[model samples]
Target: MAEPRNCSECNDSLYGQQFILKEELPHCIKCYETLYCDNCIACKQLIGCASKDVLFKNQHWHGKCFLCTRCNQSLVDQPFATRDDLLLCSACYCDEFSAKCHACLRVITPGSKKMEHKGFSWHENCFTCKLCQETIGTRSFVQKEANNYCLICYEKTFALQCFHCMKPIISGGVNYRDQPWHKECFVCSKCKQQLAGRRFTSRDDLAYCFDCFCNLFSKKCAYCTTPINGLGGSKYISFNEVQWHKECFNCKKCCVSLVGRGFLTCNNDIFCPDCGKGI
Candidate 1:
């Protein structure tokens, strides 16, 4: 050989030997690989080709160097998080920054799907209806003091249905005969007049306003020949299947009121005891 070339890395003569050229200087294979390897962001050292490497979030790290700060577990090729330049595994991140779900009491991790309402948060699968156990994620829901409910469950559990419309009565509903009805739905069965906040009567399952109840259902009073309003426990007298107002039960001949005292009826007429003896 005419001249011996000195390797720049080890200062050794490279005479007919395999080597690498780096930056216009000759370097041995071992030195050349070490100098050009990827640098580890975590350890801030060159990661040699023989050493395992981890690439995360557009950064590189040595396998053992990429570890959770809190748990000290290797995060190579695994899910991890970063907080203020501190690496953390999924479990350690949850322990540090997650909240307990109100329903299931499980830790809710950051960057996971969650449901929130009224300042309370839950995991996507943990948020469910109290009565039905149906998941309410991304659906309409009703909450009642620490309880979550779907619309169907909420209506069935809390709201009463109007008897007329057969739908849930959410507010301002009326109760008649142990049945529930909406304020606007409580109407007369015959005339369709509103019965809420007004006088009405019920025969079987049907409701009627005062006028409709009297005209359609009440019996005619014998004396006045008018429909008797016997609703609300109003007083009336009956003789031989004929109905009369309490004030109308009087002697037919003398027109004397015969309420309470002994009375008689003859030929469809009511008479006081004295008026009956005279007749």
Candidate 2:
């Protein structure tokens, strides 16, 4: 007669009753479940024979307990991701941890091209010029007022135009008379001398250096015979189609002051009324 089977742990008789084989050793159902069944990682409960067991990374979990840490959705046979060792569903993972494009404000998934600038990220196709609407892939760009633009579009849209050359002034330009101009283009119209960072004058909407303007346009003082440029707020006297300095406008014979007083002209010389009789 064959030997009778018995439970290995409890030593219970296993004659004509359901038993479990653990490592080729016969064990009672209660003993096998209590001694050898896997404990669920999620709920810390034992997984029995009638219960569905889920396995991941050598950790066991009950089917109902296997869920995403963030959304609490079941991760059974669905794509999932792990962040900081926490289980997460694909959608929840992207929403919670993925990089968002700065331009389009969309998710920048893994394995896709991305660009980053000033702590902001962008999808490759979405990073484009705001004005031209063209992709700026690994190319030079400008950011102004929270908008991105390519070099060409930035210059055309925001750069100052030189009043003299009529070209775009990208950087380091001069401003004169509320007009913009390139440094090299801001030159005297008469002598072609550079006028930037120097005293200059304008006539008929044209720029001229101080020397050139005084020599060409300033009127000569009748008494002093010197150019009266009216610079430094100096006052001058104008009469009989001639200009004179305030101190030089005097009678020729008596040397009396003639400013705001009646004067007489003798052979292109100014004399007071009393001095005119002697002359």
RMSD values for the candidates in order, in angstroms, are 15.8, 11.8
C-alpha local distance difference test of each model = 0.83, 0.88
Q: Model 1: how large is the Cα RMSD against the reference?
A: 15.8
Give residue 68's lDDT in candidate 2 (0 to 100).
Answer: 98
Off by over 4 Å in 1: 1-5, 14-20, 23-25, 29-60, 98-100, 108-113, 137-139, 160-279
Candidate 2: segments with Cα more than 4 A from true spot: 1-4, 15-18, 160-279
**Residue range with the least summed lDDT across 10 consecutive positions in model 2:** 1-10
Count of backbone clashes for each model? 0, 0
The per-residue C-alpha lDDT of model 1 at residue 145 equals 83
lDDT of 2: 0.88
